[model samples]
Target: MSKKGKSRKKPRLPEEQDLDTFEFRPTGLNLKWTKDLITVFDGYRIHRCYDLTFIERAIGEGQMPRSFVDQWRFIRTILHRFAAVSPKIPGVMEKYKRRQVVRFVTLVLLTIAVPLMVATFVFSITAIAP
Candidate 1:
């Protein structure tokens, strides 16, 4: 295959995510949730403060997770088991809760809907040209 047939490099996002702006400190109240999150994400090598912050960023702020959609999905998958318990995880509530709705909707739009739309647009253009 010709080199042109292969995809070019992806562009860097204009503004790099300021992950430094956030911090996640596990506490006495939410200790169980934090431990459970670690257990659920086992083998992903989540070991540092930054790792927790990244997950928090993804779920709470609607920012993209760093190449860990599989783990992210797993984290979300167990939500039914953990989300409604006594003390909620700090990251997945209010800004990222079913109660708020807006954050979740925006996440869906950015991750799923926009990508689909872009693919359709590209397909339509190529189909029309040829």
Candidate 2:
């Protein structure tokens, strides 16, 4: 094929190119969320310390039969569960949740509205044509 007839491929811009290596650099929002989560966990730990102390005393007194390994495992499990369901961080998580909901609703509306608009435009044009 002649060079003139051959289709030239467009060169990709830097922004259009796919990244080869992905490094997780947390954004300001993510850092804020992390700080809030840590704060909540710290507060939760402070409140639960007395319960933990009581449990430890019970085990030491032979009232609750639990091995050291079992006790550690139990504590770890409780902390993990708490972290998973930690109450919504007052501003950070609540805002994130609301944004997600708004985004979803917007996408759903656009998905329905765009096709309807296009169909209406096409029908109107056909009606106007001879």
For every candidate in turn, the CA RMSD to the true structure comes to 21.7, 26.0
Pairs that collide, model 2 = none
Which parts of model 2 are misplaced by more than 4 Å? 1-89
Query: Which ten residues in a row are the worst by lDDT in model 2?
Result: 16-25
Which stretches in model 1 have alpha-carbon errors above 4 Å? 1-100
TM-score of 2: 0.33
- In TM-score terms, candidate 1 sits at 0.24
lDDT of 2 by residue, 15-122 (tens): 322234523232333455446435644766653322345434544676543343243443444555565554545576787689999999999999999999999999
What is each predicted model's overall lDDT from 0 to 1?
Answer: 0.51, 0.55
